[model samples]
Target: MLPFERIITIDRESKVPIYRQIAIAFINAISQGIIKANTHLPSTRDLSKLLEVHRKTIVAAYDELEAQDWVVSVPRKYVAVSAKIPNLKPKKWMDEVNESAYRALFQLPFKQIVVPKVKSNAQLPEVIIDDGFPDVRLSPIDDLLKIYRSYTSKKHSIRNATFGSAQGSLKLREVLASYLSETRGLNIEKEHLLITHGAQMSIYLAAQLLLAKGDVVVVGKPNYSKATQVFEQTGATVVEVGVDKSGLLVEEIQAICQQKAIKAIYVIPHHHYPTTVTMSIERRIALLKLSQQYAFAIIEDDYDYDYHYASSPYLPLASSPHQGNIIYIGSFSKLLDPSIRIGFMVAPFNFIEQGVALRKLIDVGVDGYMQNALAELIRMGELKRHIKKAKKCYFSRRDYLDHLLQEHLKSQVSYSLPSGGMAIWIVLKKEGLVEYLVQHPQLAIRRSAIELNAFRFGFASMNETELEQAVLLLKKIIEGFELQGVKGQL
Candidate 1:
């Protein structure tokens, strides 16, 4: 007998149709090489008897597989595996036919736009380094579990059980408004808030609401890649403003605005993405002044303002008014958990009605129960305690990363010690440095090139011990790069 593994397991209670499930099992078997190419499969009658299903059901399953080109029927014996299967390459004549079909469908006469294929999440290599995610290992999960159980045990609030209002739960908004006023000095009412899926969605929605095709928007050089993509997708022309230690160059922004067609300025003033440099108060004032004179809006993305390791956090530009020119965006993802997916935009009161309307069309609203739960957390001062604890944790991690980098990779790379934020942007001493680092067997996936030599290291996720190991590995990779003498321009 052939070494074919049994692939089908019928789940009578499953919502999936039986025939479809059977077809999937067969395809899985074929892909796994359990059922070899050109091998004979048992007849429908035999399979029906083995599976305790009607003969018609087995026939239906086989017919479905045949329709998908997974198998071919032979006369009076058994079904032979087909030369072609969907998404499977069978090193045979079928490859030529499939290649021709694919070319006909995807190839164009003109110069084709090369779109990078999106890697599935499952295909992405797991990051064993401490820098890949936030440090959730130390989270007070026991406390949270207790809170969750207590909250869920109560009678389900009908308001929270259904899709929430587009404005988010009023209680959450009210709590947030007070928190912002007290913490960040931004005095805002609940009516001006529109909860979103996350900071990215808020940015995307704001771009959609404010920008038109071919409109000009100034973005900081080496900014958030995801934000850049969102603006590009909206058909806006993104002009990059250079940054020094003080943050974005105000003169470059003024020069762009002078062109008289710019729509908005996107910035992360508290701690800029990748670079982790905070904009000075003078620069913030200049930016706000430019927005007033130039007739464009400012998208103030206050992404990591909640956790300041330094003396105190800087107040957001939105807190100081330039008369409805600022659209302030904030998120709880970093403070709580990324999975929470809760963010809010504080717009001018005049724009709130339309903004909420747009939000309704997007996701209907943020998760109602989560919103209510967060509201309760805020009301009970649990969120405040969480933020305080998170700040201390992040501060320790940031300091440890800085110390390790300086101690290990000092001569090869340089980065500023940021006061706050989850990441540090390292500028390599030589161009094409990341490509060399990633070639190491240990770091073949984790290290990625942002532009050329510049890369981001998110240190908030790892503990001091893990960070030490990572730094040692990174140093070894850099030493190898130097030995190779691989020279390229940044």
Candidate 2:
């Protein structure tokens, strides 16, 4: 006889009735072949005694088993297992076949997107200094959360589950129209604005809408790689323009315009990537005038316009008197945190309408409640106040990092303190210096070789202690190279 006690343990506290537990256990045992077909089950009275339950509980368990065809009544006043049982086998082979067939037939040709590899947030190095990234520690998360919850709780507001406008929450657009006019000198209405996941999305939308195969898209030589990838995906030929201390050489771009029918120009005029050199006022004016003369679009990616440490930064080109044919995009990712995917595009209403149709096809719509909460943050001046406080903290950090670099790395590399953005570009006196540092496991910072001699360092995310450690590591590496006398020519 099979021992019932060892096979099944009863949980007196379980919400499932005691009898149901017994029945389920027996059924599972039969299906698993632990209890074979045609086996005799103990009598109800005996089971009652064995299980320490009332005889009625045992009778209920037996009745359940009989109903499920696991056991049946016998003429000898005994219960016997049903002759037939469910066939139980692992479906591994079947699953593998289905997956293989799907993979062969259902895969899309994926285009490679150029994305910068950032250190994982889950496990960061003890000391991390990189191109400027926002410190989420300083984000007004609690206030944003409170605002989100408030909007969600209001039953009348469509901030709950309803699909929002593809152009973005109208409330957010209204707030941004006023906000951008005051802050960046851009006079635009809500209708001209299209909210995006980030500036990248805005760039992609503009590329798909404005560009054609073999069309020319101009970019700086060491430009934002991701934007380059976006333009390439739209089948546009990317023409590289030279960038100097002032910014993109407008003359070079003008030369290209004369040679080819330039469809658009992608620029990060405020703090150019990897170099952090602000575009000179003259170049800004020239680029604007050229855009008019050539009849090409201007895709201005103003990613980090908020963290200016020196005198008030120059107003964006979109705010300039010559603002036609411009698709101005800005991101809240830098202001709040990168994870908050909120960016806005300022363009003509027709362009926005086209972007909305494309956005719906891709993303359907963004989070309406979150956008509304951000709007409230702007309306109440919480975001503005936070930016002011954060700018001061970042200014101090930037100056400290600059001092550390001068003290430790002055002999080995050349750099200029950036006027506005989060990073400093350092031209190394030696080649392969960065590749050597990358091999070590302890340090992680954004390093990119500029020309054959320089690399960029983004310092906005690091604190004083981390900055100190990073500078010390850099100093040690250069010393190690000197001690070994391992100098390589570029």
Error of 1 at 173 (Å): 0.9
RMSD, every candidate, angstroms: 8.4, 7.7
Clash pairs detected, candidate 1: none
lDDT of 2 by residue, 1-490 (tens): 6667766668899899999988877776666666777788888888889989999998898889998888888755789888786545523222222122345754778767667555444455555556677878888978998988887778865634255688898788999999999999998999999999988899889899999899999999788887888889888899998988998999999888888899999999999987898999999999999998889999998999987777886899999877469999999988888889999899989999999999889998678988988998999999999999888988998899889988888888887788888788887776667665554456665666634456667777778887898889888878887766645432
lDDT of 1 by residue, 289-322 (tens): 9888888999999987876778799999999977
* TM-scores vs. true structure, each candidate: 0.76, 0.76
What lDDT would each prediction earn against the true structure? Answer: 0.76, 0.83
